[model samples]
Target: MVSSDESLPQRLPPIDRALDRYPYCIVWTPIPVLTWIFPFIGHMGICMSNGVIRDFAGPYLVTEDNMAFGRPTRYLRLNPKNVDGGSSAWDEGVSKASVLYGTRMHNIFCDNCHSHVATALCNMHYENRTSWNMIILCFWMFVCGKYVNVCGFVKSWLPFLIFISIVVLMAVYF
Candidate 1:
């Protein structure tokens, strides 16, 4: 007899780093001075089912594929299966959020990149929840995100490390 699990869809497409494609994922990149001082803070974007990225880069600008800050150093791959309509629903959610955000002003405190990602997740109703927010998204990404590679890992943390080191040396010396 065939197993019930056999009817379920297979895994999502693989991430292609060279192409900056991360299907069904939330991608993150560190901001220059902000992330160096506070490692948990960074820019975020959501990927379409086909791995294309959509992010609120600035006021009324929702860019595709080209992230505002730079490439993603960490990512949290989400399962399309979690959505009611799977991949198509995931793409629609990202699209809808991008369009909506494109008309809104970008506020570093409230409406920002993290807010954009949260809106997409809420639109998709991932995990049957619609309470996604910047704080929640930020916390989850910081705790669960995986570095794209060794270089990605260094890019995310090295600057923060150097900043801390300098602070410690200054305290000891002067």
Candidate 2:
């Protein structure tokens, strides 16, 4: 028997990298030196129903379609059906969180990009949970996120791999 829930995936819009549109996705990008050392760490953002990205860029700043680090190298697409109001609720959650973060100060350890994304998910009560945080989000993205493409895979891990190799070589020599 076919279920209505089973047809959700067919209704999602295709991702368009050229246009920088990723509907219902949590996007990620490397943070230069930081991400080069720890590949799991990076900037993150949430997207609207139309796929426009929204991120807490800095203190009192929330950017649209302008990720703080760069274009997203990876993304974790989410199911809107999990939201109470579906697409509209998802958009509202992202918008609410972006606005809230716009008035706050950026903190690397506490309140930052990841927090912004989490707030959105919490607002939408995603997966029936409001406990989203940096650790959970980071872990999920690292485990489940998909590379935008081949270039994305390289961009995300190449620097870390090179850094590790150089360190190993230095240790051997010294």
Error of 2 at 96 (Å): 0.5
Q: Mind giving the per-residue lDDT tens digits that candidate 2 earns over 37-118?
A: 9889999999998999999999999999999888999999998988888898999999999999999999999999999999
Residue 108, model 2: Cα distance from true site in angstroms = 0.6
- Best by the TM-score measure: 1
**C-alpha-based local distance difference test score of model 1:** 0.94
lDDT per residue (tens digit) for residues 89-165 in model 1: 99999999999999999999999999999999999999999999999999899999999999999999999999999
**Residue 102 lDDT in candidate 1:** 94
lDDT of 2 at 7: 64
Cα RMSD for candidates in order: 1.7, 2.2
What stretches of model 2 exceed 4 Å from their correct place? Answer: 1-10
Give the TM-score of each candidate: 0.95, 0.94
- Model 1 weakest lDDT span, ten residues long: 2-11
> Backbone clashes per model, in order?
0, 0
Tell me which residue pairs clash in candidate 1. Answer: none
Using alpha carbons, what is the TM-score of model 2? Answer: 0.94
- For all candidates in order, the CA lDDT equals 0.94, 0.94
